[model samples]
Every structure is written in structure tokens, then in C-alpha cells.
Target: MPGFPRRLTSRAAAGLALLPALTILLVAHLGSTSWTIWISLTSSRMLPNSNFVGLRQYETLLNNDRWLVSAQNLAVFGTLMVVGSLLVGLLLAIAIDQRLRVENTLRSIFLYPFSMSFVVTGLAWQWMLNPTHGIQKLVRGWGFETFQFDWIVRQETVIYTLVFAGIWHAAGLVMAIMLAGLRGIDEEIWKASRVDGIPAWRTYVSIVIPMLGASFATAGILLSASVVRLYDLAVAMTNGGPGLASEVPAKFVMDHLFERGNLGLAAAAATSMLVTVVSIAAPLLYARSRARTAETRR
Candidate 1:
């Protein structure tokens, strides 16, 4: 007993060690969120003020055409990016899981893009997608003079281009997630499928994918967060250009908060984003918790 460490003492010491970090997080992040929410309810513009004008900013934000466009753009981008990334990532993971001779090399190449900053990814994709000196020109030079790959410059298609770049950047991360899930799968599943005359694709589609719920959830959460704060990619690639065609909510908030000196509107937009994320996430988290509780009872 003399040589043993007391559990209460250890726990107390750990809590004490974490106290500073916990305090900082509460003050910095929580305080900032509360402040933003409060600001959104007020008439603050160009600077903070105590003048309370509740919901005015929200009403204005709802009416703003640019804001509506940004929301629509985000909706399109989020849907396409998430679906495309998941599909491409799953395919890549399945391919790499085949235990090819160059599996590691291929995985490294696939995951390399995720390691790069969004700015770098955006710029690289931008240069490659540029109409004048990029793919279109290169293809035209090769004899197909009418080949049109100028999506980046078209207002209707620029957002799709962003989605493409986003998928290219995020698919590797999703692949890494899916690959881990694939590897954790029991080998017997494969043997059983082979014996039962089930194709590998069918096994993956029905059984393997269903079993990888946690992996999919984890990847979805990460990708969803990226989708919410999509700023740098849009900035570096299109700068919300071709007449606000590729504008996203984050960029709208940034432009209002910084460039346009509309702090109240920006805060409202930020608060709306926060509320939307919470609205979606809270239910999922609650359901997950309920499921775990039921499992425990069983």
C-alpha cells in the first residue's frame, strides 16, 4: 500500500493539469460564440456597440440576394463534394485493398493531397483548370480545337469546378478512413462470400459498407466541418468570382465582417451556420447515444 499510487490523487492531479486548458477553451471559444450570437442580435456595424435591435440582421440576411446565392452555392457544393468524395474514396479504398504490389505507393499518392493545405490544393487545381493556359488549351493544341473544359470561368459551372477540386482534395482522407475500415473487416467475410457464390462487389455493397458505419460517420463529420468552413479553397481557386457564382457562406461572412464592415450581418450569418450544424448534429448525436445505451442494457 505504501508503494501504490492513490487513484483519487492521480485523478485530482490530472484534472488540475487540465484546468488551464479547460478554462481557456471555455473563455475563448464559448465566450466568442456567445459574443457572436449577441452581436447578431444587435445593430453593431464597423464596430461593436450596445444598441440592441433583435433579429434585424437576420431579416436583412434572409433578404440579401448575395446571401441567398451563397447559401444555394454551399448547398450544391456540400452535396456534390460529400457524395463525390465518398464514392471516389470508397472506390480507391476497394482498389487499394486488393493487396496490389504497389499498394503502399498508391496509398501515399492518394493521401498526399489531404496533407496539403486547401490553399495549395486550390491554386494547383486552379492552374490546371484555367481555360487559356490549362487543360482546354492543351487539348486544343492536340487537334481538338473545340474541346471545352472551361468550367472554371463559367458562372453556371464554376461551382462544379470547386466541387471537383474539393473532391480531389478530400477523397484521399475519406479513402484513408474507408481503407482502415476495410482492413479491420474479418477475413472470414471474404471467404464466406466466395463460398456462397457472392460477388466481392455485392459483399462490399451490402455487408462491408453496412459494417463500416462508424468509419463513414467519422469521415462524414470531418468532411461536413470542411464543408461548413469552406473559404480558403473558394478564395484561392475562384475568389468567389465570375460574379459571385462560386460564393459560399463562409466567404459571405468574411466579406461582410472584413471588407464590407457589416459586423452585425456577419455575426448573423455565422450564428445561422452554427445553428444549422447544431440542428443536424444534435439529433444524430442523441440517436447515437441512445443506441449505445440500449446496447449497454442488452
Candidate 2:
């Protein structure tokens, strides 16, 4: 072959080497997603079948009380998890960065929860939050007769319990993110702020936080994704609770997909979730892109 044709062949071989990863991505992710979209438009029963029914499944999904509640619960849970984790994680990181002793041990203690599967951790949290046997019992044993940490058992407050466990499980990851961001800052910044007579708290609030915007954004996105897919924790903790109080979208999808034998409805719910995620994520991505373009221009 001529030189140009040989060069083309070499480039084609390099591209072919990526085929395995591309195939996995398409098959495992995009393929399944496309199938789900197709199935959502059909009247599939326990297993998917080829009976097209247009938007009936979506209409039914829209009218579903459980699905509606799950959406609301996800909104509340997502907000709490993302904001609470960020604040608590930033505080933990700041405190640990204060030249304290045993910092590594403390960091490990905080981070170890992130390493464990939420299945076990969620169950452990459930046990700890159990009304008759856990915190209430232990505290009551200490002679406080009216201590009520029984929110976990209440329909109105069970979602908050999920938030608590979620924060516990996820804040460590946030802490690690923020801590890494903090460490990357120049030591001169801290010294200059100190020399300028700025209080450490003000310095952190005004100067450090702005500098750590990328870190906060990263942690927030991670937490938001976790919140969207918050099934395992809810299942292990409340099992959709005292009359569907803690129902979330992922659990709703799973229930319909398996137990209810309504793949169409499940697919509709999944599509709704995807839409919601895109709706929320699109603006953030657009803003980030614009910011990058402006920075590059500057």
C-alpha cells in the first residue's frame, strides 16, 4: 500500500482498539435505555412484549399517586442530601485541617461509611432508628422518660430519617473532596489573610468558599445523582414506610418493574426520572459552559 493508505490503516486499527469499550457502553447503557424507551410506549406485562399502545402508559404514570409521592419525596430528599452533605462535609474538612492530632484516623472514621455498601449501612441505620429497640430505648434507659426520636416511624417524618442516613453515608465523600480542594490552595493565601487581620471564619466564608466553587459543584452533582437513585437506602431503612411515606422514584420503578408486573409503567417512571434529571442538569451545564467560554476569552 502507498504511504497515505498505510497511515489510514494504522489510524483505523487504533480506532478499532476502542471497539470493546464502545460496545460495552452502547450495549449496557444506551441499548438498555433505548429498549426502555421503546417498552414504555408499549403495553408490556411482566416481561416486555411487542404490543404498542402509544402514550397510555405515560398517562397512567402521571395519574399514579405513588409515583407522584415518589417524585415529591425525591425532590425533598435530593435537596436535603445535597445541601446538608455539602455544609457538614465542608465543616468537617475545615475542622480536620486545623492541625489537629490523629487527622488521618479521624478522616478514615468519617470516610469509612462511604466504602461500605448502603445495603448494610442502611439496615444498621434502620436498627439504630427503630423506635422500640434503638435510640429511644437506650435513651429511655437513662431515665429520660419523654425522649422521642421516633420520627423514623412516623409517616410525616420518615423521609427526614432517610436524609439523615444519606448524609451520614455521603458526607465523607464530600469531606474528602473539599479537603482535597482545601489542601490544593496555596499556603500564602492563608498567611496573607491572617496578616490582613481577617478572622479565620470570615476568611473561609468569603475567600476559601469562592475558591472551592469547583469542589462544591463536583460534590453537589455527585450527591444529586445519589439522591436521584436513592432506592437501596430507602428500601433497607423504611421499605416505603407507614403507608408509602418514604417512597422514592427508584423504589417506585423497581416495584412496578418486578412486583407489580407493570414494565410499561416502570419504564414510564424511569423516563420521567431521566427527563427530570436532564431538565435540572441542562441549565447547570449551560452555565458551566458559558463560564468556561468567558474564562477562555479573558
Decoy 2 TM-score against native: 0.94
Taking the tens digit of each residue's C-alpha lDDT, what string does model 2 give over 1-298? 4699989989999889999999999998999999999999999989899799999999999899998999999989988889999999999999998979899999999999999888888899999999899999999999998998999989999999999999999999999999999999999999999999999999999999899999999999899888888999999988998798999999999999989999999998999899889998999999999999999999
Model 1 regions lying over 4 Å from their true place:
1-12
Candidate 2 stretches with Cα past 4 Å from truth are 1-13
Best-performing candidate as measured by TM-score:
1
lDDT for each residue of candidate 1 in 1-298, tens digit (9 for 90 to 100): 7645787789889999999999989999999999999999999999988799999999999999999999999999999999899999999999999999999999999999999999999999999999999999999999998999989999999999999999999999999999999999999989998999999889999989999999899999899999999999999999998998999999999999999999999999999999999999999999999999999999
RMSD of each: 1.8, 1.9
What is the Cα-based lDDT of residue 47 in candidate 1?
99
Q: Which lDDT value does model 1 have at 290?
A: 100
lDDT of each: 0.95, 0.93
